[model samples]
Target: MGETPWDKGYASPPLGEFLTKWGVTGRVLVPGCGTGHDVRLLAGKGADVVGMDIAQSAIFRAEAFPAVSRECYVLSDFLDLAASYRATFDWVVEHTCLCALDPSERSAYVDSVCAALKPKASFLAIFFREVSDYSGTGPPHPISREEIDLLFGPHFECVQSFIPTQTYPSRPVGSEEVCWMRML
Candidate 1:
């Protein structure tokens, strides 16, 4: 796989705000962390953050970034993380990862997240609610509240869900939903 155009130089505004409000300060996992912007943010906030990406180039680029140089970057498939990682993370921060996966793999994504998080650990995510065009082909596949509920509801409890005022340029004003959930 090649580098994605979605690899932004900075973390998304919603992610920044989430970190500010939540004060994530323990072991954290950032799956599909392309370029590690989010991982850097979490690590800067005193969390032991591990940024994981399937692409070796992405992990290399993430580790090369001066902002995240001290942070850990792993080249591994999120869906098949090491067994030792199970129930190890205090929090999981997701940005574009869920939307980037094929819709068919969403259940697996949720399972992977559940396996990685500690009991009652928080899962903070910014989901892309709408796509500019719905032609069905996308790295950023469109998602909805119903879909989120269906995928994560069984294993996690929805703590909060709201439309974020701040978002990346690629997403529209109301196209993103910031959801906070806790593993059950």
Candidate 2:
């Protein structure tokens, strides 16, 4: 299979910076964790982190990471895997997953994310934004604050939601970025 363009070779800087500031030492998860870069980052900082991806190729590559060798990577879709471990994580990190799905599926994605976390768990997400076509069909979707409000605000309280100063490394030119934290 051809490579997924979204699997850039480094950790997402915005998410990484947030994890550094927020501290992820307890049970943590990285969903849609292509190549497991952020997974390694969280585990390196002492979180008992697990990474899950829908793509077998991504998981195969992820399993070779030292962190995955420690049993931190799973080959599964984030939405479908929770029944295998109930209320299992204190925190969930959503990188570029939601926007990748069709807008029709976003509600289900939100529901699935909510179901995967422990009660009162925290969720952190980062998005790449540019007023462009790629944003409309993307793993790096461009979402405005309004979209976030419509999608997540009614169900989760905002911990923080703001434009990010730095974009993810290797992100396409002309992409803007936003990061949000919501408490369940």
Candidate 3:
């Protein structure tokens, strides 16, 4: 691949906004973490962070970056996560993974997250809720608020959700939604 299109180069602003209010604790798992921007951010917040992606190239790129003490990058598929990862994290932080997946795979994604996070652990995500292609074809199939609730409801309870004030400048207005949920 010439370049990772999803590589934001910096952590999503909403994540930083969320962290300002919430305490980072225990272990954090960032699935589909391309280039580890969010992993480094969480690690800086003093959590043991793991950035996991299915692509080895992505992992290699992530590893090349300077570590923030407790952060590590791993090559792992979120859908069929390794057994060792089950119940291993206190928090699961998501960025582009949900929209990148086919909508049909969402339930499996939720299942994997539920399995990865420990009981009562938090799951925070900054979801892409706007799409240019209404015809629907992409790694980025945008998600609606209702669908997000329906998809994750069985395993998590929503703490709060809001339109983030901090967003990428290139994105359209209201292109994202920040959701904070706790595992049931």
Please, what are the lDDT tens digits per residue for candidate 3 over residues 59-99?
Answer: 99899998888999988899998999999999999999888
Best by TM-score: 3
Clashing pairs in 3: none
Clashing pairs in 1: none
Residues 3-55 of candidate 1 have per-residue lDDT tens digits of 56787678888888676676876899999998898999888878899999998
- After superposition of all CA atoms, the RMSD between model 2 and the true structure is 2.8
lDDT of each: 0.85, 0.71, 0.88
Cα error of candidate 1 at position 35, Å: 0.6
User: For model 3, what is the error of residue 153's alpha carbon versus the real structure, in angstroms, after optimal superposition?
Assistant: 1.4
Residue 121, candidate 3: alpha-carbon lDDT: 92
